[model samples]
Target: MEHRRLGDSGLAVSEIAYGNWLTHADGAACVAAALDAGVTTFHTAAAWAEGAAEEALGAALAGARRDDLVLCTGVFWPEGAGPNAAGLSRKHLRASLHGSLRRLGTDHVDVYQLLRFDYRTPLDETFLALSDLVRQGKVLYVGTAEWTADQLAQASAAARRFDVPLIANQPHYSMLWRVAEAQVMPVCAREGIGQFASVALAQGVLTGKYRPGHVPPGSRAAAGGEARRSVWPLLMPDLLDRVGLLRGVADDAGLTMAQLALAWALQHDTVASVITGASTPAQVVENAKASGISLDLDVLTRIDQLLGSFVQTDPRLTWSPPATG
Candidate 1:
């Protein structure tokens, strides 16, 4: 697998990293499959499946060299109902990191990220906490996720002010989602922060699996719980149409829709890694193939048109870009 630098931190990660939150303990096969398929990088969040995901990933990667791959995880979510259970406050950050390390079975995570912007907690507090982790060697690098330009600027400034390193930021960016282009991407570029783009497949919408009135049996839409049309409205007519268009482009390229979607996201220079969610070993194998393909600009242009006036925030985080500057 080809690797890209995570900003200026000198850490290189595979273009398409494996994600294991959705799979449980019984799904170690999926974990093994990812590592076998050259997915050296693994991306997960502290709150995913209440840490089960990290536990499973940790057990699966036990024998691998810790430094050979980049392990990224994030903080700032309700891990418990207590007041300190969530947010980027110093207390929660520390507790979360400790819990995460224990779950991941590692003393430290290579890249420790503030998963989201906390309106309540001051950015300084978050930066200080992350810096302390870095200084203490419980974390190698610090990054942000889903933060606005103003929030990111404040964090970066605080990092510099406190003499700490903030190396990366994870955002949603794909052929279907481009709002980061106008805001977050530039911030990272100016600050030399690497971007780990998530939702690159728009929660399987870009996989070309969901169509008008037709949802695959085991697909996310068909899961039919909180994840069905109620959560993401996969039945949206426009989304379905875009899927049809993308499927055609994938066919012409002789690539699966999922592969084309992931490849297109990886084509961006600013994107250090594209995080993928897999429920099956086959899915992991298929997603790994995306790491090796590069999409042509002409095809991307056609994709832009089908996506219509882009959306910055979709229900499932599959944002679209605007039509004009």
Candidate 2:
């Protein structure tokens, strides 16, 4: 797999990172496939499956050389019923890190991220807490996911003041979602933060499996609840029709629609990795192939022309939930 330095950090990560979000149940087989396919970075979160994902991944990677893998996990989600169960508060961050380490069977995570900006917590408190983890050798690097440009600027300044190594940001970036490109990317580019683009496949919409009127059996959309809710909006008939037209572009480029979509996300210089999740080993192997593939300028132009007006580019679309504290 091709490796790139995460932002200005010296840590190198596989261009394709395997994340266990909705697919944690398949962690053993999928993690095996990813490792075999030369994938070194594995991402998970304490909130995923209520920490089961971390346990499964830790078990899956038990025998692998620790030095050769890059394990990433996140905080800032409600993990319990207590008032301190969520947010980036120092107490919760420390408690969360210890729990994550115990579950992942690792002493320290390569990258520890804030799943969202906690409006209730002081930014300084959050950064100081993260910096403490670094000092304690529990976390090597700190990052954020789904944070807006202004939040990133504030965090960037705090990171410098606290001397924390804030090296990455996870954003829901994809061909159909270009909100990050407008503001987040520029801020991150200036702040020396690389992006681990999630939802690069638009929750499987860009894969062309969800047709205009049909949702494939055993698909994420078919499995109702959170999966269905997350992908439902992207299942618009018009959007699916536009996604269907991209098959020709993928065919012409000798790539699967998924690969085309993933490669498109990797095309950005600010994107250090495209975080992909898989329910099967085959899916893991297939996504690994997009690691080093490069789309030509013409292919990119064709994608834009084909997906024109269907794309969501409002910077305001980047958001986080209000603090209920």
Candidate 3:
């Protein structure tokens, strides 16, 4: 596994990070496979599986060397019914960091991120809280997910003022979904913010498992989960047809469709890591191989030709604070 510095930070992360967003149930096996495959970065979130994901990961990494790994988790999603149980307020931030630490069975996370920007919270309060966590030795660095470019600028300024280690950004990026390419990528590059590319496989759409006219058995969409449901609209027949066209490109390179897609995401200079998840040890091994593959200009042009006009590159698709009831 190739390691890269996360933005301008001193911390080094594997190019391919093992994530457990949807496969929290296969935590131990998947984590072991990743570690065996030379993967040193592991990402999870407190909101995943209502915290079961962290527990499972903690158990899986119990015997690993703490200083040698980059373990990341995040806040900003509800952990309970209380009004203050979520968001980026100081109270919630403090509480969430502690909770994440307890679940991960670690003193501190390598990078503690805000899962989403909270428009309702004051930037001062949020930065101050994050700084405090650094001072308290609960979090080494702070990051954001799905934050707009303007928000990143403000946060970057606040982090500097507060001396908080704001080192990375997590956003959805894939061949099929280019929402982060427009504004977010440029701002992050300018700010020296490393990007942890999420949904790099476009919710498995880039895996080429979903046929144009038939839903494969035991696939993510066929499994019928909330994550799959959220991205179902992108699984149209036309989209699949375009995806099939890319298979020829992958075949020419002697790579699987998944590896080709992952390599494309890693091709971006601003991308520090491409986050991938798997439900089995075999899948974990397969995904890790993408880190070794690199795409050239000709292959990229071929991909663009095959997927022309079908890619979703709208920057307006960025996430926002959920409306209160």
Candidate 4:
């Protein structure tokens, strides 16, 4: 897999990062496949399965040399009933990192991300706390996820003031979702923050497995619960029909629909990596092929023409949940 520098930092990560958000049932096999495929980055979060995901990823990587991997995790979701169980306060950040380290069996995460903007916590407290983590050698770099442009500016300023190594932002960027391109990307580009794009396949929608009016058995949409809910909006008949047309584009380019989708997202220079999820080893190997494959300009134009009106580009659509009371 090709590796690129994360933002302006000297650290380089794989073009495709294996993320175990909702698909960690066969973590060991998938992780092994990713490693075999040359993927050096693995992303997980404390909120994913209430920290079980980290434990699974940690166990899966037990034999690999730690220095050879770029391990990333996120915080800011409530891990307990207490009011302080979440957010970016010093106490919570410290507690969360310690818990994450324990579960992940790691001394320090290569990148520790703030899963969301903490509305209640002062930015000063949050940045200061993060800076301390870096100083203590528990975190190598810091990042944010799903934060708005204004929030990114604020955080960038605070990061500078505290001398924090704020180098990346994890955003939900995909073929169907272009919200970040409107505002977040510009701000991050100026601030020297690269994007680790999540859901590059739109939760498997862009894989072209879901037909115009049919939800295949054993599909994420058919499984129900959170997976279904996450993909339901993109399952509209018109969108699915339009997505079906991309098969020709993929065929013409000698790429799978998934590969075309991933290549589209990686076209941007500001995107450091595309965080992909896999339930099986084959999927990991397939995604790794998209790393160095560059889509032609004509193919990009064709995609825009096909999904023009359906694309979600409203900057206001980028949002974060309010702090819990």
Q: List model 4 lDDT by residue over 25-110, tens digit each.
A: 67799999999999999999987888899999999999999999999999998888888998888999999999999999999999
What C-alpha lDDT does candidate 3 achieve relative to the native structure?
Answer: 0.88
Worst 10 residues of 2 by lDDT: 20-29
Q: What is the C-alpha lDDT of each candidate?
A: 0.80, 0.93, 0.88, 0.92
Candidate 3 positional error at 181, Å: 1.8
lDDT of 1 by residue, 1-325 (tens): 7788888778888888887656554468876887788878888878888888788788888888887877888887688878678888899889989998998889889888887778777778878877788899998888888777777788889999876779888887777667677777778889989888888888788887777878788777777665575326546877788678777888998889999989888877789889987877898888888886877878988877777774444423422221110
Can you give the lDDT of residue 62 in candidate 4? 95
> Pairing residues by index, what is the TM-score of model 3?
0.97
> For residues 131-170, what per-residue lDDT tens digits would candidate 3 score against the true structure?
8889988889889999988889999999999999898999
* Candidate 2 clash pair list: none
RMSD list, candidates in order: 4.7, 1.0, 1.3, 1.0
* Candidate 1 segments exceeding 4 Å error: 229-231, 310-325
Whichever of 1 and 4 has more lDDT, that candidate is 4
Who is ahead in lDDT, 1 or 3? 3
**Can you write out model 2's per-residue Cα lDDT over 255-319, one digit (the tens) per residue?**
99999999999999999999999988999999999989989999999999999999899999999
What C-alpha lDDT, on a 0 to 100 scale, does residue 178 get in candidate 4?
91
TM-score of each: 0.91, 0.98, 0.97, 0.98
